[model samples]
Target: MRFSTGLAAASVLMLASAAWAQEAAPVVASVSAPASEWRAVAAENLLVIDTDKGRVLVELAPEVAPGHVERIRLLAGRGFFDNLLWHRVIDHFMAQTGDPLGSGEGQSPYPDLKAEFTFRRDSQTPFTAVAAPAGSVVGFLRSLPVQSQPDALMAKMEGGRVSAWGLYCPGVAGMARDDAPDSANSQFFLMRQPYPSLEKRYTIWGRVVSGLDVVRALKFSPNPDGIVTGPDRMTRVRVASDLPEAERPAVQVLDTNSARFRALADAARQAKGADFSVCDIDLPVQVAGAPAA
Candidate 1:
């Protein structure tokens, strides 16, 4: 399903058109809340990618995929992503980059990472339920939407806790792998739309908390496999932590643990009903330069 800003994705089941077609207001309003309900984007977990179109700010998900996140930090810190072309960009699918070869064949000198498709959820995990329509529970682990088994069944599992994985929502970033699940290396992709098919199949390690329009504005390759000729290059990529203090992007995301977030989730549930998918709602974010008062 495609979940774009302020619009339901094509894959999302449409409810009564008459009712939902005009219900965008509630969803938009829910995006704004008290400043107290928000938190700053830690420099250690932020990625800033500059392209010709614009800058794309990604919030790394270390808790979900620590190894992959560390790889991103290590690579970016060393200027490995500079001038890397977005070699593969499928329309309405995702834009893949980080391949030094610019032909989907090259990767960094780093060794291939084992697939981190899912992570263990424990009591310390700050997951807030947005919906529980079926046996599965849909919620937020910070800014990422996740679907997992119910709590009752979690304790009986081998890990004695529920298994949760990030949904392949728009603006989500994932590793690009070969046929083998463990072949992912330096290559990665940013989703242009929500694709449930990729769930549990790719390693979701971060999300674009801002500049999604810039992501959409990216030029796609004419080729069917998303290989662009003279593709736009990432002028520079850097982990915020490595940047000078004055130059860092001090971002803030809506705290899922806040009452405001729960209210928004409730409003969304009321708006979509059985048709509601967690991807339908994009997490709200702001920069430190102009935080909500």
Candidate 2:
């Protein structure tokens, strides 16, 4: 099954309806938080993609989409994703790749994965709410923007939890599927802009913590199909844990639960007023020991 861009317009409308005033807020160069306010990303959860253009580092969220994360880790570890063409790239939207055929109609040998549109969030989940609307809470689940049912509803549910889904913010990574709900295999896309309509439709497994500019810089097609001629390709893709000690990149993200993050969120809310969204916050990330883009 192919990843389709037919609903691009509808996606924009849905985001607008949700009062998302602007694109993702630009990430600040640095944040002045104490060492304790920062948390290191585990090597196993880091997906490193070195494209012809640059290196893109994504922080995989296994808690949000465990199966999809496993698929990515498996593929990357086996060198299945290396040298795959980014055949489809939409301007201000996303870049799609991981098809061996270099066309949309391709997939890994593995069976299609069950859709993981949303996940259950219990009291043990690491959610730091930034805003509470009428019924839902918008927050961060370890750097990924998310919206979930209020914590109060957890007591009323049979599982003692509520549902939470990742927001389609810029730099977020989502699995691509066909018309079928569970058709996702190996093809995926890195979002270049926010599109809320995809929030519960596609499975989001991670978010790009570094080299977002490289994602946006991908070649996009003027044609409505977004199929590029002579498109860029991923030179190499590997999980950080698989790389040697000196080759592994280290990443640290500002803890959303920290007071510094709260101040940052407050400033953003004050600036955007009623139009603020959790997607508007770009959590600070620090990357070290990675190859230069």
Candidate 3:
């Protein structure tokens, strides 16, 4: 709706900051926005989430998690992760879901955000990175994959400069919260593996430029090892403003805000940190202006 509370969790340092994870919270998004309102940022440069299987492109870094990509593009253009499911398959690592109340604590009528840790890739991200190691809030976008920290610390306490929100992996999406950091609301996840304690806590924004094998074929529901049991139905979730605006799908997000993503993070930190394996890092995509595929 109209959304309240207002961005940055109403400041005052969101409760003087520090302290997080109340754990056990996913009821499937519907908190009802009020942590100070903000969520709504996708003028359209490519978002398309359409999942029944073949289409998972999510390149909305908006210069690094601009308020968690404008609150998941105003809640995935409103359909709010339609149907929501993909629960929590692990396999190679990653394939969570946006939990429209799969009960991961992800419910969000609104109001939750207040983490978005880092950003500083620049010129409004264009592409390239992959050196990986990051964790002050992450860095690296194509050489090995990972970003955020362009001007974080909440844009230096809401002063200016943005771009930086890469932390999770695999299909890397975000929202799901509870231990604090404003409590997320729309429970979300998608990182085949490599947590590193969820660098910058959690709120990753977007990734998976293409259909990571239908999110690695999703189908794991045991949880407890980490707490993500799902899949009842989700034969849906098609966003991109509900496609068909000539079949909306034009993409191009590799820019960690770009300078060739720090020269591919210096060729992925001088090559060979075991030669990459977070599914071989690949948030690279290209559908072009008129719906190419």
Candidate 4:
């Protein structure tokens, strides 16, 4: 599903202004707690996409979109994404790639994936609530910001569990599907800004933990059809676990259960005020063994 919102575009400015008020150093220091306060990105789930523009590191979320994540892993392991162009990019919106043919209509020979837009949230899920107002709960399932319906609705659901899904915030990765919701295959897109209209329509499989600017810096299509004649291509894509030990990039994220994350979430809530959306906050990520900045 493809969606854009003028209101969300305006909301981006509000989030930007709030972010501008807080310096990176203090936040970094606060989030740099003990080793227990950080969760290392699993090697198998780490997606390393080296594009002509720069490298983009994505941490897959199997808990949220299992099928999509599995497909991404399959494609990357087979090198299906190598030399794939960012065929469609809209300024301040999103950067799309993963089509080997460099056209939006292309896909792998692999079978199409069914939509995994939302999943049943179980009690075992490690969701830390950041906001609970009335009937909804907004929280972090690790680094991903998610929203779930009220727990009271669980009994009405098929599995007696409430539904949850990741928000389409900046740096979030979503599968690009055709009009038929289940037509998604190899193509995907990364959000350059928050897009609420796309919240429940598209499946969010992973997130760009770092290098969001790299996504924003990609060459964009000038025409309305979102077709780029010659765009920066993803030269190579690999799962970190598949790489040799020396070539693997180690990454860690601030633990959501830690005081640091709570403090940051509170600060963001305070910063955005009346216009606060969960998208205003970004989970801090630390990278080593490679130049992330």
List CA RMSD, all candidates. 6.1, 2.5, 18.5, 4.6
Which candidate, 3 or 4, has the higher TM-score? 4
Question: Compared with the true structure, what per-residue lDDT tens digits does model 3 show for residues 101-161?
Answer: 5544446677777776555555344433333345433444432245544333444544444
For candidate 4, the clash count comes to 0
The lDDT of model 4 is 0.79
Q: Which lDDT value does model 4 have at 217?
A: 90
| Candidate number with greatest TM-score | 2
Ranked candidates (lDDT, high to low):
2, 4, 1, 3
Model 4 ranges off by over 4 Å: 1-30, 152-160, 290-293
Q: Write the per-residue lDDT of candidate 1 for residues 1-293, one digit (tens) a residue.
A: 01121122222232223233333222544466778989888889889998988889999989899999999999999999999998767556678899887777788998999989999886668788888767888888877888888777866888677888998877899988876778888988898776767788789999999888888888886544456777888988998888877778789998988887777777777777776777767677887642111
Stretches of candidate 2 exceeding 4 Å from the true structure: 5-30
Q: What is candidate 1's local distance difference test score?
A: 0.77
Question: In terms of TM-score, which candidate is stronger, 1 or 2?
Answer: 2
For residues 108-226, write the lDDT of model 2, one tens digit per residue: 99999999999999999989999999999999999899999999999999889899999999899999888888899999999887877788989999999998999999998876677
In order, the Cα lDDT scores of the candidates are 0.77, 0.87, 0.49, 0.79
TM-score pick, better of 1 and 3: 1
Clashing pairs in 2: none
RMSD of 4: 4.6
Best by lDDT: 2
Model 2 scores what on Cα lDDT?
A: 0.87
As a TM-score, model 1 comes out at 0.87
